[model samples]
Target: MTEPQAREIIENYLEGYNLFDVAGMLSCLHPAVVFENVTDGSVTLRTNGKDAFEAQATKALALFMERNQSILAICLNADCARVDIKYFAISAIDWPNGLKAGAILQLTGQSVFTFRDGLIASIQDIS
Candidate 1:
């Protein structure tokens, strides 16, 4: 796909993610896609395939009562894209101590995605 096409795909995926629509977000990933997260300064999360990614999302959805994410920007190349996202979270279902009853934590993060055949083959998140 061209650079423009890759940008559009990434933009659409970001929009879906902001909505917390797991299925919509998953549609952008290839069947054999792997997603990794490096939040704790270490790459710990590894979702080997789409199914595994969905399982993680399921657990997250059940854990958080409310969530909102917004895309700050997107940089796209021929076969890759990076998106900056700002998010707000309210984990009412499992609120830990030190946080108020309905605490909103604002977070800024970035996601890098490598595309193959117009679909995401790999995604790595840095927060």
Candidate 2:
């Protein structure tokens, strides 16, 4: 895909994520899409295939009462793009460490997306 098209696909996916629209997000991914989440330089979660990814997304959404992502920047090259985002979420649970329900949390992260046939084939998230 062209650079603009590839970027648009990523943008759409992020928009879906902010909206908690599972179907919309899934529409941008390939059937065999792989999603990896890394924390502290270690792989924390990995979901393979569209079905698995959908389940993971649903579970994540359920943990937050509200969630949003603002795109800080995007760099596109060929069929890949690096997206920097400022993510915010309000937890639905009260944690033992004093984080209470409805408390907001903010994080800055980057997602690397690889596209195949105009759909996202793989995504790796680092925060």
Candidate 3:
């Protein structure tokens, strides 16, 4: 893929995230896609394949009463992209020891995307 094509894919994925559109997000990923999520320098979640990703995405989306991902910067080559985002969300349910329902959360994060066959093969998110 060209650099712009890679960037567009990333942008579309981000848009899906902001919209809580699991199908839209999955469309940008390869069938065997891998996803890793890190928070505070620790890996919080990991999943492989479209089915696993869809399950996680659905669960994660349900926890957010409102969510938005605002892209701060994007850098891309032919096969890789890095997206910096300002993320905001409000909890829809209470956690065991985390935020309560309706609590607002904000974080800055980066998602590194790897592409193969014109689709995202993997994504590693760090915040």
Q: Which candidate is the best by lDDT?
A: 2
lDDT of 2 by residue, 7-120 (tens): 788889988998999999999999999999999999999999999999999888767898988889998888788999899999998877899999999999999999998899
In the predicted model 3, the residue pairs found to clash are none
Candidate 1 displacement at residue 9 in angstroms:
1.9
Regions more than 4 Å wrong, model 2: 95-98
**Candidate 1 lDDT, 1-127, residue by residue in tens:** 7878787777777667667788888888898899899986899789998999888876776655677767799887778778898878876653655676466778999889899877988999888
Q: Which sequence of candidate numbers ranks them by lDDT, best first?
A: 2, 3, 1
Flag the better candidate by TM-score, 1 or 2: 2
Error of 3 at 115 (Å): 0.3
lDDT for each residue of candidate 3 in 1-127, tens digit (9 for 90 to 100) = 9988898888899889989999999999999999999988888999999999999999898798999988899888768888898999999999998779999999999989999999999999999
Using all chains and alpha carbons, the TM-scores for the candidates as numbered come to 0.84, 0.93, 0.94
In angstroms, the error of model 3 at 17 is: 1.3
Candidate 2: the clashing residue pairs are none
Best by the TM-score measure: 3
